[model samples]
Target: MGRVAGKVALVTGGGSGLGAADSELLAQEGATVIVTDVRLEAAQAVADRIGGAAVAMALDVASEAAWQQVIGDIEARFGRLDILINNAGVVVMADCEDTTLEQFRWVNAIMTDGVFLGCKYAIPLMNKGDGGSIVNMSSTGALLGYPIFFAYSAAKGAVRSMTKSIAIMCQDKGYKIRCNSVHPGAIETPMVQEASGRAGQAQAVPDGVLPAGAVGAPSDVAAMVLYLASDESRFVTGAEFVVDNGLTIRP
Candidate 1:
């Protein structure tokens, strides 16, 4: 318990799925959590349930003004920011040939631009206090080509690369903030469920397709996120950790 005792974490998109799991885990570990999402009511609900030491805020990851506001609020309320989980993302799948400019820009704005803004704004807060950890959520699609998800893949790929750039920049600037990205493959979340249902298929990860036998739960990804957000990975940075249940390397 208390793996991150005395720390404060800001989890974007904390209203649902993996973000919700991450927020709950961080609170359980004795860290004050800020559950931020574009959905204010959803964020409030999660924060209220976590109780003890949690707050809710409307954090639109794609907005620079919102980012600034959240950072300032964290500073005023928590005195310092220790962890920034850049988990807010959106995936609008369209074939490259079918991809519209609006569709492409929308996904990239949130997935890639949001990560850039988070790291850019959070680094100063982390540098001001003890060095903090920033965990950006990418996907296995970023590493592998999924013909159905052209824009999402591109945005996530950009997120992965952006993570590396942030890591190198932090090292050069002597900022103690460590940046890394998480690549989850076919995790069981509302989004994935929606995808599967849209496919009208009962199975998400079939036996031969996924070595794990089934899709992973949000908690499966939360465990890894906690480790990254905690001091356990004090020296890890610029690395992309894949929690795909062997989907990435399965034959």
Candidate 2:
């Protein structure tokens, strides 16, 4: 419960899925959390669950002005930023010839651009304090391609590569920020369930099918977030932590 005590963390898309999980876990660990989402009600609900230490804000990741305001507000209220989790993303499946321009831009805007702006705003704020951590949500698709995840995979790949790019840049520029991306293959969450259901994909593995003999809960990812958000990973950055059940390694 103490891995991230006395810190302040902001999670974009904190209303649901991985973002909500990260926000909840961080708050449980004693960090003041800022839960931002496009859905004000959803964000407020999460913030309520986290109690007084957490607050909700409505935000659209694509707006630079809104981002500046959010950053400024956080700085004024929290006094310092300790962690920024760029965990907001969306996936739309369409093949190359059939993919629409709007779909492509929509995915990239939320996934890639949002991640880029997160690091952009967070790096300097983190430097204001001793240092901080930034964890971007990528996917196993970042390392490999899937026909159905054309846009999602492409954006995630960019996120993985961009993590390295900015990590090196921060190191060179002398900011004490460590940026990495987590690649999750499959997990049982509302978002995953809904996506698969809509696609008519097979249900997740039957219970006990995992190599570890258990499906991953959001806590698994939250554990990684705790490590990245703490000094425990002070020397680790610019890396991809693949959290799949060896799915990416299989032939």
Residues 57-148, candidate 1, lDDT per residue (tens digit)? 99889999999999998888778999999998787767999999999999888888888898888889888999889999999999898988
**Each candidate's lDDT (Cα)?**
0.89, 0.85
TM for every model, in the order presented, reads 0.94, 0.93
lDDT of 2 by residue, 169-212 (tens): 98998988889889987766666766667443434446443675
Cα miss at 106, model 2 (Å)? 0.9
Each prediction's total of clashing residue pairs, residues at least 3 apart in sequence or on different chains, is 0, 0
lDDT comparing candidate 2 with the true structure: 0.85
Per-model RMSD to reference? 2.8, 2.6
Query: Clashes in model 2: which pairs?
Result: none
Off by over 4 Å in 2: 198-215
Instruction: Identify the leading candidate in terms of lDDT.
Output: 1
